[model samples]
Target: MPSQEALSAQVGAVYTTSTGAPVAEPYAAQRVGLTGPLLLQDFHHIDLLAHFDRERIPERVVHAKGSGAHGVIKVTHDITDLTVASLFSKVGNEAPLTIRFSTVGGESGSADTARDPRGFAIKIKTDEGNLDWVFNNTPVFFIRDPAKFPHFIHTQKRDPQTHLKDADMFWDYLSQNPESIHQVMILFSDRGTPDGYYMHGYSGHTFKFVNKDGKFHYVQIHLRREGGAKSLDNDTAQRLAGENPDYATEQLFTEIEAGKFPTWNVFVQTMTAEQAESFRYNILDLTKVWPHKEFPLRPVGQIILNKNVQNYFAEIEQAAFSPSHLVPGIEPSADPVLQSRLFSYPDTHRHRLGVNYGQLPVNAPLAPVSNFQRDGAMAFNNQGFRPNYQSSLAPLQYKRKAYEDVKHEIWLGDANVDLSYVTELDFEQPRALYEKVFSDTDREHLIYNLSVHLGNVKSPIVKARQLSVFAAVSKDLGDRLAKAINHPSVEPLAVKPATEAIRYKLKAA
Candidate 1:
């Protein structure tokens, strides 16, 4: 390890202005007299204060509380046949990568142990370009409709008038959009409060992998930790939320610094377009998962977090990842929520980090950038002396297409404004999860967690509606939740059928 003095010398031993001009007396400000008011001409003193005032850029709206590390992604298997992404061109191939683990729907000061979905975003700097897999700890999400996202996130935030986390606000949204029941059940379970950043990751939205021949396959990415997923009970999680709010972030940094690197095996489940047509669930639905029994995981690579970031703010905080950041062979599926994110993520980055956010050292791609875009806020490298438009004098070379543009012929359908309505199909996975997968102990913990939270909701209507939703999934779960909360049992509501979207279309017409 280098000494502090040596590290300081690498940049500069003496303090200076943002423009690097040496300061004679950084401590003293120019003033009229010994005890007089400080003069505005003291640029050194004024500059220091000014820079400190604007020190922080806007924090992320979602995933604001985060911890990250530098690492390497090494391909462990040959997946060249699946896609032409250079990162998996051959076995043992490696690329520098960064991983950020965060809690969704939380402020920068929010507790790490809060019962919420965790954001597991990874950026792999491959030779072709940067490839980011913005994923979640859960395999599925709450809602599939794109428009429901902002409304859903608002429910997770504090109430405007009350300025507090409102149980009514949360449950009201969930109950109204019963399609969210799958994730709601998962959230009320032990998995909601993960033990630490050491959790399995999944690409909740299905993506596409185009082969060299332009034939594409719908893909779901997974990251399984070397050790299986670990979780905390409701009591332990709540206790930790109060006792150690930064537990997960601190644990990740400390473990990495101590040379105890965490590793996750990367896998992908692929389905051809023909197979997707006959799949049990709509492949583009974010609220569903492709069962492993039908589509098993194929090993691709290993992600090892071997290095802790030197500066959290510079390296990790400024880092941005998006599912839209893809190389040639990787493409996004037409998942509605994902289509919205393809625009939203980069837009958020531009708002938070300026239009030239890509120019930042942390977010910059390794590939040499040659483009017409120039001159925005903080445009340090403006492609100096080059024409902003195409000119015969200074021509730029263009790379040929690696393969033909493969059209998704199977996706051809009547184009219209579509809305996914709640249906029995939406509840199938959560039902299976509760009835088949969860153990007796898991069920007890889940019921206890849900009861404690729901018991706080003051509205009888919200409670009844949510109970009905739960009953639609499993009678045992609904009855247990009602018993735990000392509420009367309610009849299960009939789920809207699959034709509900058509009904919506007819209503609109």
Candidate 2:
């Protein structure tokens, strides 16, 4: 046998597969003849193909295309009075965080510059536990009820019959459900197609924040990009969609690699229980927003992305987040969408990952875990020979923390009904957004944007119906859209079909 040093040097010169078989040539596959089919006997080729076949896991239902980076969330201001969440306990404290930015409806292969709301999700690993603030770039969403979520998303996707994106499907759904107007207005505006991942705001739909002494307040988290929001025009975004579909993803990764780390200032808008009750619009409604005049943002911390994942699938795809994974100082509110998501998120992870998905290194909590649950598929870290149950003889002890120790407010409401309804207040924000918030230039761009998409609808009825909703928001908005689409005298349609007599009377000389 060779000496130890000589043996090590010889071993280091050879390359092998996971099974320790030396790979003679990695470039070519073994074949029967020059142009013949590959040989199955070649284990290397078989292994490569087998791994490639299963390379793709299930893509997310929404926010499918995204980019993620590792960062540090540093508390700049002391909010210990508001919450005892370790990440925000004191100034100068920092925690490891990972953030993902994405287009809400696009696929993994879709254009990065598409005109859509960006998903701004952050996962903070604190000493207490992991806290996830899965937010969106837009402060409000398209619908208030979780039941409508599937339907609304379907409209954004390709039509089932044609397998192509349908303008009629998009407009018809929004026309039928007026609650989508606020998001629709924002989507048509210039801000829809952000310049890149670095430019946008993040909003946590449900209020969730807690302080020391068990006091809690309904809070909305905000992440304002240090560079401020920027966007490409329709022409530029469309051109880039054809030329470079992954422009935004490449931009983010390259910037970070070049040492230009992106940062955002985190803030929160807080509301007391009485304030939530006396609000003009339902605070629980995800489609609406609490005006800044009443609830101003309070600065708390900053987040800076300093590292990139070495492997996309292992770090980004396998990383799981859920609203229900709250730490001691945080809790969920009565927001219906959020309440539904509390269950849906973990359920999705179980489906996509294995039953014991949390055991994965990416999703695992830093804190120790002890529970009665045991024995599922892919149980990599199954406690060896330990009784996976509560027992007296085993000397396993349980500590019960006081409910009051965690920050949460008790609500007294009937839990029997599935509360879902569209109210007149649904249109308030959208109307004000169109009239007061958007400037003349923004309004002009909105009209141009709406006309570009709406003009493509083949059905005149669908076009008229959608225009009527626009008219309901504002007569000028309706008139402008109608004019842009070459229908100058478009009238608002009735909620129900009009009778022949009613139509005749209205049209009478």
TM-score of each: 0.94, 0.88
TM-score top scorer: 1
Task: Give the total clashing residue pairs for model 1.
Answer: 0
TM-score for predicted model 1 compared with the true structure: 0.94
- The lDDT per prediction is 0.87, 0.78
| Displacement of the residue 60 alpha carbon in candidate 2, Å | 1.2
**Which residue pairs in candidate 1 have backbone atoms (N, alpha carbon, C) closer than 3 angstroms, thus clashing?**
none
Residues 83-151 of candidate 2: C-alpha lDDT, one tens digit per residue: 767777779998898778889887888999999998887888888778888888888888767888899
Query: Residue 81, candidate 2: how far off, in angstroms?
Result: 2.0
Candidate 1 residue 39 Cα shift, in angstroms, is 1.5
